[model samples]
Target: MGKRSRWLLWMVVAVGVVGVVATGSNGGAGEGEGKGKVLEPVVTRIAFGSCANQSAPQPIWNAIIDFDPQVFIWLGDNVYGDTKRPFKLFGKERTFGPWKNAPRFIPSSPKELESRYLKAKSNPGYSRLRDTTQRSRWLLWMVVAVGVVGVVATGSNGGAGEGEGKGKVLEPVVTRIAFGSCANQSAPQPIWNAIIDFDPQVFIWLGDNVYGDTKRPFKLFGKERTFGPWKNAPRFIPSSPKELESRYLKAKSNPGYSRLRHTTQVIGTWDDHDYGLNDAGKEFGGKITNQKLLLDFLDEPQDSPRRKQEGVYTSYMFGPVGRQIKVILLDTRYHRDPLRSDGSVLGSSQWTWLEKELNGPKSAITIIGSSVQVISNLSATTRPLFSLESWGRFPKERNRLFKLIADTKREGVFFISGDVHFGEISRYDCATGYPLYDVTASGLTQAVEKAVPHVFSLIVRFVAWLTPTTMRVISKNCRFRSCTYGQPNFGAIEIDWSTAPVTLKLEVKDIVGYPVTGVKFSLVELQSRGSVPSVKAGEHRRHCSLEVNLRWMIKYRLAILFYCSVSALLLAMIGLAYAATLAFRLFLHKCKLD
Candidate 1:
């Protein structure tokens, strides 16, 4: 072996290492398939976190990658750059330096915000970890004492199994999911690092992704406004869709959001703040324009009906039958009926579509995401109190939803909601079916100063009713399972398939990713209680027949009475007209036939 031979060996070793890092051993996307193939993971490990404050040091980034989530979810409040200010350079010297900073400094402006996103994209940590066509892969490892190792499965084109006992295709699994909401850009956001450590396969944005362009004060400005302003930053209220788009551009560029964008797949819907208003609904003027911008920001499919439709509600199914999971995102803002409207909360078309979905097919677990609380009411004291924005406001619709679940006996169905700046769990155990659980997590950055108090006084309740916008700032009293208020927190839902019946674990974690409170439910517990006792056919028929006979008799009497009265009136009127005509004819005969 000479010097040249030794040099050749060294070069070979260097190239091999580079290939491993660049292409990844888990299986690069479209290795053999060719260009532009849709890629996914065989097993999804979602890391969900929201309420991002761009200026804050996101220590959570360190923790996020430690957990090694396959996807990152932005559950609303991704940024807090709210302002009516334009992209103009007003106080550049004040915020930046003698050296100019273009985008990030003006956190709320649209045009200037582009630079912020560019800056975020340039982050070395995010660039290195971001998912790419070359590095797309899932490295499955059993959690060990010190680390995770031991390859389980690996392939390209969304985790195709490579020769498992003579080439068996492995189905994708949705194992871990995390979510949260309500972030402020100026606030301290170390919790993101903790979320990274938790390591999820996918993240779900529960809404309030940003506190953009809101009139509400950052802290308590007045008794009427509970939610604070966007980190008390300079206001940047977008008047047009283009300006709003600019705001979105700035939000996407936030380092935390930017890093997550590269690291994993993200999906989300909007709350009032993100939708360009506080507690907005169907009457929102710029809904269509704002919706278009939102879809573009979310990278929604060009062919999706959401483009043509009025709302943003959508559903997605993952995995095969036995292990399948369905995620349903309900658009609570767009096309929502007015608070006290006679129609419905979900509107007519959406209501019909929802019913079809619930009755159509069954998934191992179904998670319904609402931007506001669904099961819990604001009142926990004596008289029932209600939230103007929650499902409680529309009792008719809420009961209809409950009845639908009971009628269809839908199983493994639970709700996840955000907003209200807190986290809690509530349950509605139906007599005819299994317990329905609603787990709400909120505020990745902003938390309430105090929980909404349980109201017992009638005077207070009446005042609240007259001024619904000024409802007391009260957090739910933990009765069902657990509750956490007045803290920046996130939520997690984990599904385990290692047993006969699948189990789901719901958790609410603080900014540091510590589980403040949690609850677990098994498939058996979510299912209907052994087909509601069947009604006897004979007895049911007898009761139905008797009711029908009674109704028919009453209807028969009413019909006859109406007919007789109408007939007598008509006869009298006709006779009177005839007599008058005869008298007129005698009088007219003396006059003219004209």
Candidate 2:
């Protein structure tokens, strides 16, 4: 062949090699789809997050290590960078993954950033998390491995007067199992090394990675801006670039994170704060446009559930074990209706997709990472401060969803989330008699939102109390459990897919201490002891009496449509009220009202 021909051949080989590495060897999002014989009874442990502060001393890493989770998920509230570009990464129907085009991999220029991720990873306490075994060979392999992608670089060159020594993009995203440790050790670093050290396969970002002036008051460009004086005491504020960079760097620098870099995988979806406000969406000025950018930062796949569907709700599976872990990353703020019209948590398009995913014949273990509280109630406070920014407001939608889960007989439905500045687990019964348990984890760094004054927050507490009784109605064959948890803490779920009855364990670890450890609960026995079940939440909204009838109606087209319409209408009413209140308050509080 001529010299030109040889060059072309070489070029093609190089391109092919890059493509393979980029898609997989470099680490792909969907690794479970691998050709390897998927092990049976897939053992999986998922670490769920809700509210993580963009601050130092996020000790929950200790709890996560103690749990030895296989996967970690960010349910939302990752940080508080409200002003940062591409702010609305969470609370949307359609979501893309992280942005790859950003200058994340470049090392030389990002000296400060490199130091940040590297030093955070190198924390001596997390050494055990990185070096899981004592053997020299294991230690050698871990130490020698290089070129891990878990290290992310963010910030800008200070063109817009951000004028710190330098500015990074300040994103709350990671796409690997582990990356660095002590990448850049800073002064007075929270004795993170003094506590339990552990590493996670994937560090899933829950949300609020940046605050973005969420709790503070004021309006700029027709958008909510930071104005202090809390609606509730110690109200949540948006995250600044420094805070965002700090949180990401600290985690990235930790050696335990290297697993996310080389050995394990990472994946996540967001809730609010990652956007700009607590319950914001596309119509919030240019927020929708920012949503697209957020997706890029997240590295979400276009063909994935969130991309193909309406909301950020998606799924992922790892290992075989005849188990599939479906992660429905529910966006609470994006397309939701205001509180006046019954309010919606998810828009119509996304709702349809959600039903299908739930009913689809696919997996045994279904884990839904909800950004907001699904079962907890907030009525004691007058402002609805504890109100239904969650599922409680959209009763119709929740009912429809419950019906779907029950009708579909979807088993092991675990709802994990953050945002309440607290944590709790509540088991909700389904029409099919199976129970859905929701676990809330908030404030990996910051403190939980305190009890607001009045009946609104009180009402929420009351409703929460009734959950066990309410769930008991559906769980005649099975029983449900419930409880409240607080932070600085993190949550985890462990699954034993080996035997006839699968075992699951839930944990909440306190990260404020040196040798961190916290609460734990294990469901060792598969209470149902039956085959995998399926149910569509919409089918049973008609108040069907017989279980057989509920299943039978699922086939009929009209029933589902009616349920959808009803849910939409209910959601709209509540949303309208909530929006009206906020709008009216803007006028009333300003002394401009007639």
Candidate 3:
């Protein structure tokens, strides 16, 4: 090839380097793989999102259905946010939004909520989930039989581990869980089946699986754990589990839940519902107590990560180089300082720990989980109540986070978040720093108007404009930036880590598997800077090819002036060819005639 041709070919190869190619290990753990530490390099793809009110994940559920993922992380707000109820343990019930004003004279405490649980557990959805699995049916039958055999064997206490606050640690093999918000169960049912059928290594609960939030204002520890997670059994109160949360989870773990029980290892952290505090953090005085209560609900063996950290923060490792994904769940609310320059997203201890983690990174990919939007430039302020409750709220901390990732040179970092009642995908350029991509999933359900923050829609629009482009406002969808915890939705993050230059995709869908307007972009692992670079994106409308432009000419009139010269050379060559042909023909004429 000519020198010029070689250089042009090289340019094409160089351009191809920036675009990411997705390939990776078949995330499926080998059949009959023991439920121990998977020593084999794990090629894992995870789906994460949060803030789903238990109504029906409308328009958004489709995303979860189509994106059949391996691990689904529930960001938080799992149930319609039932606080003050017993750590609710019914099957599952859903509330469709347009947010309803909570009822007055709410169940006083766990005892009261237990009664409610009895009523709610009768829900069709709840019943199906509870009685779906054979093992679950057997357990239910056993619970009944054991109750009948009580006193003779073990006195009033009934059967073994009955109502005993001490939870049994069932080290999981593979668990299958259906992901859908509230009444929207069928929406992502296929995804759930895939999880079960495929039987991955783990499953996650992102949060907002139910919506039993108390309408009346609840003081810290206002309500208590209510009723048994199952049916009419001993209504005993152990520590932990907020009133409604207990009932809600019990309902979720129903026979329907059994299908998922022994399938895969499950781990999760809550964003809102389980705690009943929307967008709440440590700053909200109620958080510490809520955190403790949540710890109680998750009370597993001491070795369980949930019990160990018990904070809203945690991490998990998956796979080798084809991809190595490390997921870091942040409390955004727990240890965060104010948005001041000295503010902090990570508390002192967590910060140090996070720094240490970031300090050591050569992994193919990393993901950060925050229930609320982190990269979205918009805030939820239709009014102050719906005002910004995203990472943008704490600019100082947000910037610092960027600096940390960039300085640490961590690559393949993405944030999977939810809570705005809507869903979106965004890539942020830190003015000129590392690249951070944040994907928000708000599928599952919607909010009733005038939820919390009482953000006025008009005010919210103004706030969107005023909101600095950098302050959590990543897109033009005004609703996306705000903190409206009213609407419900399911969220998910899909990662392809089987090949070099890992690929991560963020998608949100309504309960029925429909459209969720969003964007997707990727980069080679080695080429990606932890943060979005400040380089301005080329904004030209008129299309122009570099080669075409380069070949056009150098100095202004040179092309026009040299045009004749070029034409002359071409003509001269043609003339020479004609003359030579004529001369040859003259010689050939004789031979031709012959």
Candidate 4:
């Protein structure tokens, strides 16, 4: 071959090696296994969402049903019963000087809230979703039972009988769980069909199960601002438990939701709205009564200890043996302290319970569900400008939780949260022994993207970009530059057991049940003794910065290498082309001289 041809061949080989290295480094675990290796099967699938308006057309259910998940979770805001309307004192409308009767908002009456829940329950699409899930569960149970009986009978005789051994049941071991929060009972919820399509076996409610608290703005006066001469002048006044109870009833009565209750295993905890107020905590007067109402909506057993508990925090274990999964649902609203107060979030009793849950029997995967963002500190990203409710509000408590996990040396633990009305995935590696991931799926219906006008989308995008959490995963699925998806979305967790190291696929899906952004990691990566360093609380910030930067580099290292290699190849080709052209010209000149 000509020297130029040989050079070209070498360049091609070099590029090929670079491409292989990049792909191999980022490829999923257990790739290129030897032939005939017995692979594990996917054992569980969980799905979740938040911020849905019950009264709205919930068309997303159809897409969810298509996913055919075995479990569904409600993160909260199952409905919007407590809402603001034009404020009136006695018989006259109140006016705030200059503003001229600027439609002050107040919480709806208990009776009114209940009626709204009832309306949400009546949504045909939601009802269909519930029915479909129930039927799927029934069929699954029957299949499992038959399969078990067949296997037992076949083995009873010691030796294979005539046709007994031939009886085979093709039951799948996969389990699917779905969850979401922040639904408005009065808004168009067109996402129910998509959720129903997923056919999840279990559903979890994270929080905002209902909008039971409405904002009560204060009026600006000559020297002081006030809540329009109201007796309490409160920013947000929670309705009595009676009103909350009514709303719960209305939500429970939702035909789609009701049907879902009968078929799929539904479980969840509460956030501020469903807890009877917005950003309320242990200070709320009616917390005791509201707690009961919330439990009743969940159909908690009359004799269960949860009913007698002060808070709704609870946990559950599913599957069996090595493939088991433990789900811990936290009540962030009931006993939470005011934001920035440095007080407790789970409270003393709940904290103790949590420790036990973490230290108890081991599960292949441990999922901790919170009603608010746990790992993402939005305040840190958007400090001074504004703050969002999150675990970061109580720095002490957040640290304590992180400490508990480290102390216990637990493995396979991650977090799922809601109430932010957007979907994103975050990972923190400083405090924990391994990279801790938090998948947040919010806005079942009430999404920030829809709430904002198209004209101001650019402004919102700019804000998102400016206020990115250190943990937010900047992936290709991001609709905005910030990697935050502000649309009707839900979270799905699929555990693939077939791989040597179990694979966990975490996703934040769109209105149509399509994944917009997600992350896939092997279960072994969540081991307590993984490569991540355990940083002391004092050294958190310094280490956090270094780790975050390192993580970014590690995550995109492949892309970086690929791009660099291509650029080099192009440069080399350009140089080679120039040299060949010069050499040809010299040859022609020499020939003319001869």
Candidate 5:
């Protein structure tokens, strides 16, 4: 590399570094490791978002803090890393090439990745927050069984203890869940505060956690690799484990993300960007290493079922009986097949597991999460219908999922998805069960009107902007309100179990936490609805009753008073002891003089 070329290369790297550091923390747990301290809170408030550019301004984090969520979810696009490749700005070759034939990128050595993670942690904003907040790390999925919130202790070194007699047990119950996707660290993101305000107990990351494609032709090889007519700038495709680790490290050190992690319990899965490339599947050779990196980042236990699998699909049951909430996170990437005319998405074993999970006894409410849309067809919005990344591309599997829900007669089964750059709530009616509602919230930082992958994308976006109705037409089954497709946004699900039948409130909010749209469903109502019902979601939204709020306030005040009284008593005793000691000393002096 020439002096100018070397400078330019450093400049690009500096751009990513400066971008994250400008909005990052001063310090954080290194190697994506943190100690876990278990707290058994009865109800949890959760927050989730995605598509964050580590180097971008994240004002949304402030608003998220205000809501006081107990947990946060990084759906995907948490960071854009992958030093192996450079993003092609313009050309016929825009999309990533095949993995097998792709060239390897440099400067993505293990040391380089570690340095990225370390620098990201050094960002001032994240450092301050992480330092003060109570944080822990461990496998969150397997431990979250019915009525239990299992937490593992975080050693001083931010790793799990290898001491003798370590066991997993049931702990606490979760009550709130927030989720979203598609964040670019270099893009504008002001959506986090709104998520924080929503105050979810558990945040579910749908996918696209980080756009970590590092496979740049020029950066990978000495010369800029040219592409044919069909390809575009190649996505950052990491061919080795080292490149993958670098991307993750960069993401973890994001300032806004650092703060959120400090304040709340977080868990998530991966999408294309963080997994290695755009629209990658099982054919990606680095699946094993990537899985380990992702799991380690999420603090998965060594004995986690995820460790035993080739992909990152897992399930958790939370809350006690009568209020149990089962969450099933699906891995759409690891073992996925190519998108053929008749294609398969979830491989055979995952399918078997999904079937088994759905067939079993159901929770009060069951949430099935997919990184991509399960019931949306954009043929209405885009002409010629070019890209099909959603479940719509795999009709057989999609129907199988619907059929399984129907066959199980599961009452509160619903889907939460994120992958598209927009947000909406779609419903799928089942033959034997209630209609399935898929809440699609995406792009914590990045949003687009259409899903077209090429230059025509600009035109599709323009048309969608001109005719907003075109976008709504694409979501024919949307139940809550109109779709949010123009700017950054997020989605939330609030459950109230105090009533005889539990109630679920679904919401899609803008970057500032304003409710763009919302809907409510009684568990009974959700179970009975055979088809899409004409209901006003705004009116039916289950609100926290005044009685409950007031009662909680009273109890909180009493607790405070009790604490004050105890503190005062301790002070009085200390004072009394001090005075007595002084008097004794005076008496001793008098006796000696006499």
Candidate 6:
């Protein structure tokens, strides 16, 4: 071969080698076929360490920050506060220069530990780590400062009301309690004025007290109704405590809420939106900082035990012994495991606390406040595609709660909940000892009907009707066929001690304090072994079953059958397409042979 031919052959060989190298670099073929392998710059990086001696050099912090971990877990002993120091046991006993006594290792006093923590916080290297991980970790100095404030407010004698009376109790014999949830701070909250007009002795906030975490404009049919290109885009994302604090301030500053706060004792627990994330659970990183912000909004004392605790669960007793009412507010956000895991809604600690509260001091009426519905499980009647936040999602936990109530035989027990964005009353009588009632009031300013277009009102009504529980239905005030009021509403409980048997009324009322739906019963009807007359009378007892109207199913049967027929038709078409492709390939092969 000539020189030019040899040169061309070498060039072709070089190009082939380059192609092979490119394929390997692009992960076309490699060890393990590169299926689950992660390349450089991994998406999520986590770093953790312990036993950081703040007094000594902290050069490792700079390198750790440089690594840019998405999460940095400080296991324990972030600072060496329990340090060793030389002690002179015999004070002023004329010890020799340095050979008299040896150094002793002693844990630091509270003040000294605090000073060491402050010193560690001021370290420049640690400050860089804090700046990088600001979204996840609460600042060490801020937590310490809050602790100091808590101690000062609580005092040595525990003057801040440590236990059951931690919440405000306005009445000696409480007869009226008003509660609601799901209020948007930016919207007009006239419902507060109505709640105050009812003259409720106590007011409870179930959750979603403010829309701190919402972004994106209200959309209808997946399109923004507002006139802007970025209307569908997220307007704001709350990543810091400041954002949540500002929203809380806006809600607290509402004139109506302020007046209600003064007129009645206000107490509350949080749901997902106010808890800093939608559908968030124990896994949310900023929960510690956000908890402080929530307590601040509630005007919790600087030294309240709630500040130091992991959750905000607490109980309050009002009135004298004969007419006493106990309100137990549960914190469902802080330690809640994820949905569908069947893990836990209330963590083990909260559950233990709940059992104690249930078995604690006797009261004529015991009201348990859960941020999510306890008795009404929408999953049973609503389509399986939809998932709502409720205790129903955790079946084991729900059963345990019921069994606890039965074992304790806590009489006059009923649940008040919010978060479903509608007003209704549910009752369960099977596992529970008595007719367990859950009065749910939601949408103080934000309602489901308002979120969608007016044209979709009928569809919303239909969906509500299809979802049937042991819902207590009164007159036509519950405009929905399923006895659910979707407009702005609140729940009210009234106890008439003047009656012979002491009548109790549970109501879901509108903005003007008009009863939308309610139930009237005697206090004796809530006993564990007592025979409830309402149940004997054959009231709605199927709690969370698939029972629905046969006529309604017949009306929609054609639509349901169409889905099945279309699925079969698609399968037939796919088979025909596969046969046609095979026949075409055979024809091509035969033509090539000819």
Task: State each candidate's clash count.
Answer: 49, 145, 122, 106, 68, 3
Instruction: Pick the lDDT winner.
Output: 6
Candidate 6 at residue 40, lDDT?
27
- TM-score pick, better of 1 and 5: 5
How much RMSD separates candidate 3 from the native structure? Answer: 29.2
Q: On residues 173-247, what C-alpha lDDT tens digit does candidate 3 reach at each position? A: 111212222312222233343334333344455554444344333233324322323333222222233555565
Cα RMSD, model 4: 26.8
Instruction: Point out where model 4 deviates above 4 Å.
Output: 1-174, 217-232, 530-543, 546-594
TM-score of 5: 0.57
> 1-594 in candidate 6: lDDT tens per residue?
112222333333333333333433554576655332222222377889999887898888756765666578989998888866655556554233454554366678999999989999888667655654652233222333333333334333344445533322222467899999999999988777578668786789899988778575655435544323445544445556787899999998886676555445678899988888888889988788988888888777677778998988888887765788989999998999988899988899999999999989889999999999987776544533355778878888887988898888799999999998989988876655578889999979878777789999777777677554444443465645578888899999999998889999999999888988888999988877644333333233455231232234543443455567799999999999999999999999999999
**Per-model C-alpha lDDT, please?**
0.61, 0.47, 0.46, 0.72, 0.62, 0.74
By summed lDDT, the worst window of 10 consecutive residues in model 1 runs over 141-150
In model 5, where do residues sit more than 4 Å from their true spots? 1-173, 186-189, 215-236, 379-385, 449-462, 465-482, 528-594
What would the TM-score be for candidate 3 when compared with the true structure? 0.47
Could you give candidate 1's per-residue lDDT for residues 171-198 as a string of tens digits? 3477888887776544556666556556
| Model 6 lDDT at residue 301 | 67
TM-score of each: 0.56, 0.49, 0.47, 0.64, 0.57, 0.61
Instruction: Name the runs in model 2 displaced over 4 angstroms.
Output: 1-126, 129-198, 214-264, 301-310, 380-388, 449-483, 512-594
Candidate 6 Cα misplacement greater than 4 A, ranges: 1-171, 217-237, 470-477, 530-541, 544-594
TM-score of 2: 0.49
Select the stronger candidate by TM-score from 2 and 6: 6
Task: Write the residue-wise lDDT of candidate 2 on 129-241 in tens digits.
Answer: 44542322232222222111111211333343444323111221211121111111222334233222334334444565434433443433333334333223323544554
Report the C-alpha lDDT of model 5 over 1-594, residue by residue, as the tens digit.
112222222343333333333432324746423222122333366778886656667666556654545466679755545544555434554335443333444446677666656665564444433333323211222233211222122232234456422322323456678888877655545566466545566677777776666545533333343344445446355646776676667666665565455444566778887787778998887777778988876667787778888799988877655678888999999878886644678889998999899888668888889998876644322323234477867767876877777777777877888887877666654333465677888878767642345667555444443321211223333332344454577888888877777778887778887766566878886675555323242222111111111333332443455567789999999999999999999999999999
Ranking by lDDT: 6, 4, 5, 1, 2, 3
